[model samples]
Target: MIITEPKPFEDILEMLADVDEVSIIGCGRCAAASLTGGEKQVLQMADKLRAHGKTIVAEIVSDPAICYLPRSKEVIERLPKNGAVLVLACGAGAQSILEVNPELLIFPGTNSRFLGMTAQVGEYHEKCTLCGDCLLHLTGGICPLTRCPKNVLNGPCGDCVDGKCGISSSPFIKEEIDCVWALIYDRLKKIGKTEILSQTLPSRNWAAKTYKPQSIELSEEEIKQRGR
Candidate 1:
């Protein structure tokens, strides 16, 4: 599941500083799971806005599932004149709503955190960077880029103490091992091959390897040949 968090209250206030009649739109899906911008949170936000001298024209309404099956049209039709929508969904949902109604002004209420599974009741940890490459096989399934405090690719530095990252004072360690490379070394020892650490990692190709938007298409002839 994708984890998300509500934007800071100050940021939200600044974003909606110009709006008078604002509609707080919530998603009954992912946002609700993270306790962000759900019906309850939206109502509370509306009350806060009213206290700040802004006129909230209507109560917050949450669709069953706004990210995938948005009821944006219904919400827009019910909005008061000159009302702007404060969307409490992921970035994709906000963009989708804008595409459906280009004239409607939309503001985001939550910051999309990461594509991660809930580690505990309220804790979420990122497990992947989607770097278009997979190296877990050599690293004992631990991603240093996402799990390590410094995002160290070469392993834990000399500063690591008792498996805790020395960079951040926070003792809230994600993995039991000191670092990904250490974990990999232990795994290799168990497999009777402790010499893996001597092998150096290839330098990453920055241009050919990036986490940016990309697209691919197949020609008509190729599609026909593939019997698609």
Candidate 2:
């Protein structure tokens, strides 16, 4: 899931400061799962905006999650196109709204954190960075590229200070990150696959790290044939 966190209300208010009539859009998928931009949050936001003296023209928790282009487009088409729109979803969903309505004033209400998984009700773990490379099989099902702060591929950096990652700051590594290479080593040794680590991984293809647009196109005959 694309994990997200709610932006501060003050920031949201500032974004909508000049606008009178506001339309709110929420995601029913990842944002809802993360407890940031779900239906309940949308209503709460509406109430808060109204209290601050902003006219609410619409509040919608998109059933199709606001990122699914076609369905979200259909939903957005029916809303009153006025003033500004506050989207409580990930960056992708917010952009999707703009793609559907290019002229509408749209603002993000949440911050896209990472592509991760839910560990509990309020806990999320970063699983992947979408690095466009897969070496999990060699690393015993762990992705060192993302888990390791240094993105070490083949082996440990040999500079870990007591098995903790080297980065810690407000915008970077927040918590005491365990050395992912150490984890990989332990996992490989435990599984009797330590030999795999000896084989060094080639340099990552930096070109593959870009966002490549994709689409699915099927001919009428192909669709009809599949119906059988």
Candidate 3:
């Protein structure tokens, strides 16, 4: 899931200083799981915005699955009156809102964390890298790309200490999370897939996942042709 964390209320207020009226949109999926963009979070933001002297025209929680254009378009169009939209979701959700409504001013109220699992309440662990190409079938379903501090395609490096990865920080590493390779090995060994680890994986095909803002659309004619 695309985890996200809230931005400071004062920061949000400063962003909206020029806009007197605003709408608050929250996400119910990843941000909800992270406790950053759920209905409760949206209302809290609304309260905070009111306290800061901004007028709230409307408040609505976008479905956690707000990435869908049709659904998001409907919700966005119904947002009573919009001067500026304070979106409490991951960066993707904010973009989706913009795609649905091109005229409104959109402001993000949260920072997108890594793609990961919710290990426990109020705690999340980064898992998948959403690398476009998935290799979980061979890697015992654990993603090393995002979990490993070094993002090694091969086995653990000599620097790995006590099976824990030296991973930390965002956009750059400074702390340590778990060593995903160790987890992958244990999982593979348990399921009799250790042999898969013996094969040295090739260098990542950056061209596959490194393309910026990738998308493909099927025209109605293409859909009809494929249906045959």
Count of clashing residue pairs in every prediction: 0, 0, 7
- Which should have the higher TM-score, number 1 or number 3? 3
RMSD of each: 4.7, 3.1, 3.1
State the lDDT of candidate 2 residue by residue for 1-228, as single tens digits: 999999999999988889888999899999999999888999999999999999998999887878897677898775575458898999999988888878778799999999999998789989998876677898999899888767778768866667766664336656777888888888989999999977878888877455466445789999898993
TM, every model = 0.70, 0.87, 0.87
Q: Against the true structure, whose lDDT is highest?
A: 2
Model 1 agreement with the true structure over 3-44: per-residue lDDT tens digits:
679999899899888887777777766777777757888888
Model 2, which residues run further than 4 Å from truth? 168-174, 210-228
Query: For residues 1-228, could you state the per-residue lDDT of candidate 3 as single tens digits?
Result: 888888887788788889899998888888889999899999988998888888898888877367877667788777654368898889988988877777779999999979888998798877787777788887898887877767788979876677776554344765655678888999999999899988899878789566777787899999899993
Model 1 residue 191 lDDT score: 77
List where candidate 1 sits over 4 angstroms from the true fold: 51-83, 169-178, 183-198, 208-212, 215-228
How far residue 98's Cα lies from its native spot in candidate 3, in Å, is 1.6
